[model samples]
Target: MSQKKMLRFSTGALLLLLPWFGGLVLGEISNDFSQCLDFFYNTTPPVGITAAGYQPICQRYKNQYHFASLYNRQSRSPLYSAYVLSPADGKRPRSTWMFEPQLAFSRASSEMQRFQTPLDQNVIESQAVLEDYKNSNFTKGHLNPSQHQKTVEDRKATFTLTNIVPQKAGSNSGPWNGLESEVLNRFKAFCNGSMHVITGAMPYESEPRWINNRVSVPEYMWSAYCCPSYRSDLPEFLKPFFPTYAAVGRNDRNSGEEIVPVNAKAGASVRGYDVRRMSLEALEGILKQRLGMPITLFHGQCQ
Candidate 1:
């Protein structure tokens, strides 16, 4: 074909495909972390995850950034959410779940917004929404659990679907939840300065799993923390846990017993969903294997 004819054909094909993969276009949640870098250990994101699928989101709510979420639009989930572990008072807020409007419209708004009645088609296509979890046999798991936030608004900001992944109920309310509580206990007991925590999901190796054909379900839930400063007089047992800590929880009962082994002695409700605590290096090695790249969760390994 002639050069002009080939150019015309290519342009036409692209125009037709635009609507099919409209959500792939990055709207407004941008590369800039200038708005909320304090959430990271040294105001630096984890190194080595340089794939196009991941986008940095400074989760803003009510005019302030409460945390940061490294979102994966293709997976319709967060790679991880980072925040300082603050004392959560009162109860889980009953606020409506929200989404990043910029994900749908480039100039819509920087702040997260609540899903509208019959949520906009663009919004629904751009990211996971409330309907994706309705009766999907999976729970909307929060990477940055509200219990770790300090204020009501900070806690409520975590309800955004961008920071969520489809997690099994067995894990959400079982071993994983227990791990969250344990981390809080540790923070309250020893951490003197800011205790930064990063929680994320791990996908199955062989094949992808999805809920509502829109959201990817995680195979394991992992978390790690860094406390730069703590009490000088530490107990013997807590020595190894100081400076940094890490863990991985089984999200699927049928999953292989390689990363996180199942506890046969556990109650029937949470049989295979056991969480295994490990060192920072151990967790990073696993992440490197799973993500096919090196990872540095905390700066200088929380030195």
Candidate 2:
């Protein structure tokens, strides 16, 4: 939370750009998330959000569909990425950042492609490129983090840039990461079936922040999950998180302490990047206030 400029650090090793799954790629974005409907509960996307420049992406990679991202064409960041919670299978994949090629050129390959040298003028103009995060003092935070996935391919597919946001090192590696780990444990413990999760970024209402004046830096990060089929025998404290639960974490340590209060006792590295857990209804209410839309994360409130 210091006023001084955030120190620069290596985000990751930009290893060789990997190959895309040549066979099963979903062509350019469409009007809806129909291609990746399996990722959503009841096969429905969030309701009440306006339809504008937001593009629906069926994130395809390595011959498989991993998740769905609702990308903002203008801000060059994803509003949300929806996917089914699955158990971790292996170590995190190498950080070979990729891009949804079809987002830039419709006739281009349907699969997400690894960034090449010099970059394409159309690709840079259409979406976020690796250059945006280089020395930008921010990390490429995954909205649909790879840790909450089932297979190696599923985890690697999350490396696509369309599903990332500009997040501070404190937030991305601090409380926000803890929350993701906790959710994965919860899924392993109680959920008997699919746990549909939607993780997203919330922009500041009054002022928006950006990295390299391109990708938007979220003021807060939010997530919600729907697990209709859960163990019937649940402890009292665990009941609330059975069918649904949600949380909002601070991406900016300097942000106000209203939505997520800072843990003064915590280490300085993660001091202000606190996370607040709440009910699905509470999260929806907050989303409505900040987004200026009546947001419903799941159908029938995931009943």
Q: What lDDT score belongs to each candidate, Candidate 1 first? A: 0.88, 0.87
TM-score: model 2 vs. ground truth? 0.91
> Candidate 1: where is the Cα deviation over 4 Å?
1-28
lDDT (Cα) of model 2? 0.87
Q: Can you write out model 1's per-residue Cα lDDT over 228-302, one digit (the tens) per residue?
A: 899999999998898999999998999999898888999999999999999999999999999887999988899
Residue pairs clashing, model 1: none
The candidate 1 region of ten consecutive residues with least summed lDDT is 19-28
Query: Which tens-of-lDDT digit does each residue in 259-299 have in candidate 2?
Result: 88888999989998899999999999999999988999999
Candidate 1: deviation at residue 118, Å? 2.2
